[model samples]
Structures are given as C-alpha cells and as structure tokens.
Target chain A: MEVAHADDVELAHRIAAGDEAAAEEVVRSLGREMFGFARRMLSDSGAAEDAMQETLLAILKGASKFDGRVPLRAWGFGILRHKITDTLRKRGREAVIGDVDPERDAFNAKGAWKHMNFAPWREDEETLQVVRDCMETLPLRQREALELFAVEGKDGVEAAALLGVTPVNLRQILHRGRSAVRKCADAKLGSDED
Target chain B: MDDRIRARCDCFYQVLSDYIDGELSEEEAGLVREHLLLCPPCLVYLEQFRIVHQACGKVESDDLPADFDVVMQGVMTAWRKDRCGDPEPGS
Candidate 1:
C-alpha cells in the first residue's frame, strides 16, 4: 500500500469533529476492504459482517484516538486487525500457524526437483484466476498465510505476529504455500486442454 | 553441478520467497542472481515465481453484505448515542 497523505489526515480530523458525513464516508470507503479482510480471517459471512460492524463502530468511537503518527488507512487496519482478533477469540478459535516445508516439498537432499509434474503456468488472467482457485484448494493453514502476506500485502511481522510465529518461520510457510499453490495451479491448467 | 555449487543452489532456492519479497540482504540476493545465471531450473523457478507474485498481488474480494449502508447507518446511530444522549447527531 502506498503512503496516505494529508487528505486522510483531514478526514481523520473531520471524523473526530463528530461530523456524521465524515463518518459515513470513512465507513463507505474502507468498509469493503475491511470486509474482505474480515472475511479472509473468519471465513464466515455472518461473523465477518459482525466483525465489520464492530470495526466501523470502533472507527467512529476511536476517531479521536488517531494521533496521525501513521497513515490513516494503516491505523484503520490496525483497528480492524484488533476487531478480528476479538472475534476469533470470542469464538474460541486461534489462527493456526502453518508448518509447510518448501525445501522438503520441492527438493530432495540433492537440491533437485522432486515429485513435481506440471507445465509452466500461462501468464493470463484466466490462469491467474486458476491460481487463486488453487490457492483456495490449499489447507486453510497455508492459505491464510498466503492470503495475509501475499494477497493482502500485510507486513510480514504483523502477519507473523497474528499467527504466533517468528518472521523466518512465516517466510517458510509462505514459500511452501506458494510452491504448493503454483504447482497445483500449473497442473490444473496444463491438463485443461484450453 | 559440483557438490559445493549444488549445495549453494539448494540454499539459494530455499529462501527465494524472501529474495522475491526483497527481504534478503543485498549480498544474499546477489549470490542468488549469480546462481540463477548458471542454473536453468532455478531460472524457470524464478519465472514461475514472477507469475505467482503477479497473480497474488491482486485478488478479487467477495462476500459483502448487500445492505451495507443500512447496517452502517445502524452502527452510526449507536455511535452517536454513545458519545451523547442526543438521539440525532449534528443537533
């Protein structure tokens, strides 16, 4: 994400002033993205919506708390992340840390390919969509890591923190997740005769 | 490939994810680039890595409620209520 500028700062000020229009604007602008984030974390539409409502409520109530130390959007995600954590905790669920070993999956002790059987993926939109589909086919543990780090562009440290792993462990999870999804997508596309 | 080179390739390929994300040190990335020039498999892997990066960097989001505005209005009402006893905001 690019750095936000003065406009967002102004928006924060307006919202803090208790302007209803400003509150609505913030909800409309970030609500969808936050919804997407909530959905990814919870994977339940009703729970996601509940979390989103709570996030929006937090934004409105906490607008005065935004000190402008970070980009407004970044601060917004921080709140959303907290809301997601609260929702997960209330449900008695924890974010599972994936232990996929890319090195073991892709290479033998000799550093060569092992158990790989697929053609290269075509660089088209359709193939990319298939890549996303293959991403969904992965176990939720790996999928969540890829979704947070790669797809959502979250900070590795934050992602690792959410999953309760160190940064190095998170990178290994991302590598193994990417390798599995890439291979699965390649095979699915190569066999499609399209 | 010699044992030393092969060992280096293995090490380099293992963390290519970090390399692709620009997480590696300059010297580590430089070493990987040098290995890429000598290894066809690693080169292909790099290309696929590009594809994965491109594909993952953008994704479509689903699962938004149809009545988002309505729900948000309800949330705003409660927010307005909490800050003050005023039933209507901007009063």
Candidate 2:
C-alpha cells in the first residue's frame, strides 16, 4: 500500500484554507515528478508545458476536495495523467495496441530457454543510457507503468489505480514492460560490443 | 543445464521480475531461492535484472521550465482573485 504522507494531507488542508505557502509547497514537492512524467508521456515540449500548467491549476481548484485518503502526490499524478491523456487526444495521438511480444521467440514451444546467452552488463552511465533508451521505446501505457512503479516509487496498488487497471493487470503490464526493456537493452549492448 | 534444471529455469523466468520486487509469496519466493542455488545462469539473469531496476530508479527527473515561475505567478494571482471575489484584471 502507498503510505500517504501525513504532511501532504496537512498541506492540502492548509491549501484548502487559502494558504499560499501550502500551495507552493505542493508545487515545489511534486512539480518535478509531474514534469518528468509528462515529458516522457508527451514528447512535445509545448504539450508537456500545457499539461503541467493545467495540472497545477486543477490541483488548486480541487484541493478543497482532497479527502485525506489518497496520497496527495498520487492524486496530483492522477490529475496529470488525465491532462496528458487530454493533450494526446487533442493531438490525435492514441496509443497503438496489440504490439507483438518480442520475447516469445526467446523460448521454444515447450517453454524452455533457447541458446541465447545472457551476459551481465557493465554497470555504468553508458549501459544505463542503453536501458533508458529502451525504456523510451516502450508503448505509452507500458512505459508509464514502469515509471510509476519502478521510478516514482509508487506501490503496486497505487500504481494500478493510477493506471486505471487491476493489480493483476498492472503486474502483467509491468512484466511485459520490464521484459521489453531488458531484451532491447541486451540487443543494443550486444551490437555495441560487435 | 539438465532437463530438470532447464525446467526450473523456465519456471523461474516466469516469476523473475516479481521475485525482484519481492512481490512473490513466501512459498513462491522460496522456490526461486532454491532454484537460484542450483542455477548459475538464472543467478546471472537476476543480477542483470537488478541492474536494470537500479538504472530505472536512478533516472533523473526533468528540470522545471524556465518560465515556470511566471506561469505559476499567473495561476496564483488568479487563485487569489477567486478567493477575494475580485474581478478579472482590466474588467
């Protein structure tokens, strides 16, 4: 379960009471996370900026409704996710569905591994860049799942709710996302070595 | 790897990501532990997966845009007007 930061709840109350400092606090605390995720989801700098502005405005308008139940950060992210979706919709960019799984060929019909070699990668900035590049290649939903879970440090249930999927479904999405990046990184690194 | 080891590796691969996140049940995780004891390749895979996980976690967040303060100032000004029942500027 995502632990709701008590201070965030308190800050929401203060913001509800028209506290400018509290509002600033929320902005300062969550702005980077929102911007980063938005940048990844909406590659266009202008779209990303629009999404962030809308998100901040929405947070201000909706702060009074904060129930102190959901984590404020997660709630803010939910709003940002909606804004990103709307931005994408306006741009007529919908997520492409039903991409073939690249990992299926790695195993046989009997579900046994093939002769592919899994070498340990050098842990450095260069290899990390490879992994990040592979991550960028993921579908929007999959990359968002990976970012929410692996990057933003959100727990399974929180991430699932934010992604609007069941926990089991979220896990499947996450597994596919991880496998895609891992295999993609492997291929890139192998080519680099060659 | 023999057929038995090969079979274990296959099963372990299925739950490998879950195992890394400690999302597996105790029994499931224990099974993975036992498999790692017998399988060197699986262990290497696990190590590499951890590296990927770490790299993802270490990803830097994008910096705030330079005009963010100006944008935020407008938002706050509007918010203040709303709170004070003030009319829009130049209205």
Which stretches of candidate 2 lie above 4 Å from their native place?
A1-22, A43-47, A62-73, A86-93, A97-102, A151-154, B1-6, B37-40, B59-71, B81-91
Q: What is the TM-score of each candidate against the true structure?
A: 0.65, 0.75
Alpha carbon lDDT at B45, candidate 1: 71
Clashing residue pairs, backbone N/CA/C < 3 A, model 1: none
- What does candidate 1 score on TM? 0.65
DockQ of each: 0.42, 0.43
Per-residue lDDT of B20-72 in model 2, one digit per residue for the tens?
88877787777788878876767877887787777666538566678877766
Docking class of 1: acceptable
Reference-based lDDT, each prediction: 0.71, 0.74
Q: Can you write out model 1's per-residue Cα lDDT over B15-87, one digit (the tens) per residue?
A: 6787789876677777777777777677777777777766666547474589877787777787888878675
Per-residue error at A154 for model 2, in Å?
6.3
